[model samples]
Every structure is written in C-alpha cells, then in structure tokens.
Target: MTDQLPDAIVAGPKGPALDLLHIVQINEEIKSVVAVAFKINIMALNAIFLAKRAGTAALGFGVLSNELRSFSSQLRETMLSLNALIHASVDGVSAMLQDSRYNDILERAVVLASKNKHLQEVIEQRENATDQFRSKLSGLRRALRSSVDDAYRLVELGGVLAKSAKIEAAYGAGFSSSLSQVSGEFDGIVEEIRTSLDTLRKSSFFRG
Candidate 1:
C-alpha cells in the first residue's frame, strides 16, 4: 500500500501551483481581449461620427453605433475585473507555495540530521513543525479552491459578455468587422479559460 500522508502533503501545495500556472496564461489572454475591446470601442466611435455626418439618413446607424460602444466598454470592464482576480489569486498561491517549499526543505534537513547520534529530540521537534506546516498547506489548498471558483465565475461572465458583443456587432456598420474581430478574440480567450477551469476542477487537489 502507498503512504497517504506523503501524497496529501505533496498534493496540497503542488496542485495549486499547477492551477495557478494555468490561470496566469488565462490572465495574459484576457489582457489581449481587453486591447481588442478598446480597438472595437474606437471603431464604434468612428462609426458614430460617420453616422452623425450622414444626418437623418443614418440616424438608426447612430443608435446602433452607440449601443456597440456601450457593449465594448462593458466587455473591457469585465476583462479588467477578470485580470485583477487572476493577479490576486496568483499572488496568494505564489506566497503560500514559497513558504510551503521552505518548510519542506527544512523538514528534509532535519530528517537527514536524525541519522546522526543523539538527534531523537530534534526529530520530534521537526515532526511537530511538519504537522503545523501540513495544517497550513491544508488551509492553502482551501484558499486555492476558492480562488478557482472565483475564476470559473469570472470566465462565465466573460463568455456571456462575448456573446453579447457578437450580437452587438451584427447591428454595426463601419465597425462591424472590428467588433466581430474583438468578439472572436474574446471567444478564444473564454475557451482557454474554460479549459483551464476544467483541468483544475478535475484534478485531485481538492478531493476528499
């Protein structure tokens, strides 16, 4: 039979690190989506200006242009919020992982020293220290899982916003191509986010 203790100890911190790496990639992609949104917003504004110059003939186009602009702004804001969530999550995991590794190394050192004469007391002390650190790792795992849930929610919001952007693009004229491009980019990013979330959720990290 395999030792469950080591398995738990190893999975506690390493799993979050793995998930955090995926989140980092998703975070960078979301930034690209933000840039696309900004470009779409500019295109929408240009369309609005053109519609205005066309006067009464293009009044409907002007209304659509305003709607597209609003959609782009909302999309960009959502992307920003997603990016912030990822950054905060990454920071938390990075710190916890660093500390966990440090403690792991110390525990290993104490174990090796136990091979020498009259080191039983040191071994007992190290065991207590390891136990405390294990509790900390458990807490970190919980925090990481909570972060993953937040990420899932954010990605879902992004996907919804992307769908709305595509719908808005259908009504735009001069800016339709630009808006469609932005929506497509958002779709791609959202797909990646979904994949990451799936991987994290299916992993054994948070399982009983």
Candidate 2:
C-alpha cells in the first residue's frame, strides 16, 4: 500500500505514538518563528538608533523604539526556549521508541491479543508520550501564531511612527527622512511575514 503521509507529519493521528520525524519538522517551524522575531528585533534596534541620532527632537520616538526592541527581544527569547524544549522532547521520544522496539513490532504481522504484557506496557507508554507531545506542539503552534500577529502589529505601529517622523522632519524638526525609509522597508518585510504566516497556519501541521 502506498503511504499517503507526507515527508513530515503535521498533526499525527490522535494516538499515543508519534513520528519523531514530524516533531523535528515542527521544531524547524518553531525555529523559523524565532528567526522572524530576531529580524524584527534587529529592525527595531535600527529604528531606535536612528531616533537617538535625531537628538532631543526625536526623544519620544527613541523611547518608543526602545520599547519595541525590548518586546521583540522578549519574544525571541520565549520562542528559543520553546524550541529547546521541543528538541529535548524529540530526543526523549526517539530514545523511548528505540528501546521499546515498537516500530519493529508494529511492522510485523503480530496479533495484538497474543502480545506479551511487557510489549503492551511499552506500547501504552509510547502512546501516552505521543499524546503529550501532540498537546504541547499544538500549544506551541498557537503561541507562534499569536506572536506572528503581534509582529504584524509592531510593523503597523512602525509605519505610523515613520509617517509621524516624516511629517516632523518636513516641519524643519531635527529629524531625518530615514524614518520614512525605514517605515517603507518594514512595510515590505511585514507583508512577507504575513504571507508566510498565513501559509504556515493553513498547513496540516496547524490543523486541529
């Protein structure tokens, strides 16, 4: 029979055992989310630097930039910690699966009723672990989705800030048009991030 499953498992069937490979794929997605946060943080820092260079005239914007950078930094750290947990879980699952020899047993034409008590216990243990990881990964996906939305808000706020700075610069304030340029750049980056997040959320991995 042809295996209908993809190279990566999105959401596994509601069973106790999961595909470690799929968990690894999920970790990759988590990393991607972290990377996006890092990029936003870098951009926010750049904005802050520009605001500081504008001196006393842009003090308010400078403060806002610092806040934005801080937010992004916090987000990145959270995602990184989550990703680490996932990696550890993956390793543990892989070890358990190997020790139980469930994959090998499952591949054989053995009858469930004829299985020994030890094998049954192992199977149950694997199933419980699988269910737990599934739940954890689901929560992580939700968190990542929320983070993406937060990033979009940041970019939107950034655009507004740029517009404000541009107006002030036009009024002969000691600010530079670089604010406007950064705003436009952020607009482009945010659009790309939105598209990517939309596609990611639509994937089978994100399915309930």
Clash counts per candidate, in order, are 0, 1
Candidate 2 error regions (>4 Å): 1-22, 92-176, 190-203, 206-208
lDDT of each: 0.62, 0.59
The global Cα lDDT (0 to 1) of model 1 is 0.62
Candidate 2: residue pairs that collide: 16-127
Candidate 1 residues 5-49, lDDT tens each? Answer: 786666563444665665566565566657766876786687678
lDDT of 2 by residue, 3-63 (tens): 6876436555332245455455656765776777688778878877887787887676566
Q: Among these predicted structures, which one has the highest TM-score?
A: 2
